[model samples]
Target: MIKGTVKIDAKICKGCELCIISCPQDGLGLAAQFNDKGYRYVELIEDNCTGCVNCALVCPEAAITVFRQPKPAKKSVEKK
Candidate 1:
């Protein structure tokens, strides 16, 4: 499985749910606390992330950054 993590710049977030809706794994949520601008930031909730970067693409403020682990390579069998 492809594993990944997300880093959200809470200060830059504008309380937009675009990232939440763009995530396929539902890994994002609104935080209980508020930012400097009084807008709740995005937080990671579920662990079913696939590093699809959908959230980052939809974020108008560019407050989200996704880090994805590389997938394992397949091995080939030699013919005897």
Candidate 2:
């Protein structure tokens, strides 16, 4: 379960919504404010991202970049 974040170039984004749809964790959404091009860009809406890069692969404009970090390992408990 590698967690990650997405960086989107709002100015370069064409508001195609492909990245938003491709995200598996539903981590992305349209921004509330418009970009320099007067188009609402995609943004990260949640922290449960898995760094799958699905959004980046589907993006036609190549406006999205993903950064991933390894998820912390869970502690194991011993039975008494």
Report the number of the highest-TM-score candidate. Answer: 1
Candidate 2 lDDT over 26-54, as tens digits, reads: 88988899988888888888988888999
Model 2 misplacement above 4 A: 70-80
Q: What is the C-alpha lDDT profile of model 1 across 1-80, one tens digit per residue?
A: 67889999998999889988888888899999999999999999888888898998999998888898766442222232
Decoy 2 TM-score against native: 0.81
Error of 2 at 16 (Å): 1.0
Scanning candidate 1 in windows of ten residues, the lowest lDDT window is: 71-80
What TM-score would each prediction reach against the true structure? 0.85, 0.81
Report the lDDT of model 2 for residue 15: 82
| CA displacement after TM-score superposition, residue 74 of candidate 2 (Å) | 10
Query: What is the C-alpha local distance difference test score of each model?
Result: 0.86, 0.83
Model 1: per-residue Cα lDDT at residue 73: 41
